[model samples]
Target: MGSNSSKISDLPKNEYLKKLSGPESISENDPFWNQLFSFSFPAPTSSSELKLLEEATISVCKSLVENNPRTGNLAALTKVFLSRTRELRLSAECQNHIFIWQTHNALFIICCLLKVFIRELSEEELQLHFTYEEKSPGSYSSDSEDLLEELLCSLVQLITDTPLLDITYEIAVEAISAMVVFLSCQLFHKEVLRQSISHKYLMQGPCLPYTSKLVKTLLYNFIRQEKPPPPGTHVFPQQSDGGGLLYGLASGVARQVGSSFSW
Candidate 1:
């Protein structure tokens, strides 16, 4: 009876230790959390581990975005991990499980994190694209290339061209960060992803095969520098031949010039 009582007495402490040691508890407040995040989202040079981290990141984003708020602000803080519409869908899914106000507040917090984490790749890593060399014969197999290509394609798809209601700047930044990391790791080499999809097939869609908003932002901001139109270059056509209208006809067409035209 005493042995059983002692074991029972130790149970609570055991549970406490488990919580303290687990991956879930490693947060910003914990000194170890940075290490965990870095390890989990390491540059792609650590291919095996990076692959695991990528899968885990996507799964967490899907779950938190879709249905899990008891997890607290972690999900909220990770909101930028998903694009805008995704957050909306996730919030709707979890509304029944959490207070609407809490969900809304959490979403704001998540967007802020995304905004901060993305505009942060170093210049050295950004330039890695130029130094890329073809893989030696046995280095990367065709299958590996295919997977990388698919991921690249997905990244491209996330970037949207919607005029006004597309993703926010914060979400765009996060997407850029993700692409920079992928580039730094050399995941999308010419021999790998670029070759997997033909130039023709890739340019067909409204968006590219893997064109994500994040990827699009990455391309514009990083891969291809979007220089402003040359100095003194006016984008709009010089006020037409009619001084801001086809002079008389432009103003008279809508009004009735002589007939008081009523639609």
Candidate 2:
């Protein structure tokens, strides 16, 4: 332990240091997950410092959702990160970390939200909301209304903050689709087909019945409105993009949702 402490202390100030700080270790009842802010990213000058700070502000969002049980925190964290009021212009080095964090964590958050949303749908609600074909075979495990709202709120913020223009629509599509796949598998349960809805809905999020439609509409409308990409423009393979730091979260949610239902 002493050697580990010394190594951590001896480590140079850099974005790498920021990564070491980790998702906060929380007990079952911490009330709020304290924001982990480590000013370890090296900034040689005042300007560099500002940039690093901005990147940190953007990059630290995942810590809020690392083990979050409520969707509200995830939504709130997204708002905080994307707030123009708090926007930080990142240094090139810091930007790399920010990008890496986003690549890994961003989509993960989405997946988690989806799980919460799907889980939130009550057994009766799921049965009612979904058609016979859409219905799974069992009961949902629990009841939590706030989950979907929290998820959609976060998703909206994510879309608004990271515009399709900056990150590109391809990345967004792949991220959402990946999230869908993940939720369908991980959160599935035998009871979900017929019994009371489970706590999974407590996390999947708000959009739900609305989200599926909203997403489809948005994807369709965007495609209809935009000019076509030039032929032979070399559309990049989305898999290489590495869904960002948030991918695990979204993937985790997807796993949950997929486990529970068909779509």
The lDDT leader among the candidates is: 2
lDDT of each: 0.29, 0.34
lDDT of 2 by residue, 1-263 (tens): 11122122233343332332233323313322122221222211223332333333333333322323322333333333333212322322244333423332334333423343344444444222222111133322244333333433444434333333322343344345433533343244544443223324423444344445545645554454443222221112223344442332233334333334433
Report the error of model 2 at residue 140, Å.
Answer: 22
TM-score for each candidate, following the candidate numbering: 0.24, 0.32
lDDT string, candidate 1, 1-263, tens digits: 01112122232343322332223422325433222222111122223433333333343334332222223323222322223334443443554222222322233223222222222322232222112222332122223223223323433443343111111222232333334434332222424443222232345543253445534543444433332222122111222342421221122222211111110
**How many clashing residue pairs are found in candidate 2?**
73
Give the runs in model 1 whose Cα sits over 4 Å from its true position.
1-21, 24-154, 161-167, 187-263
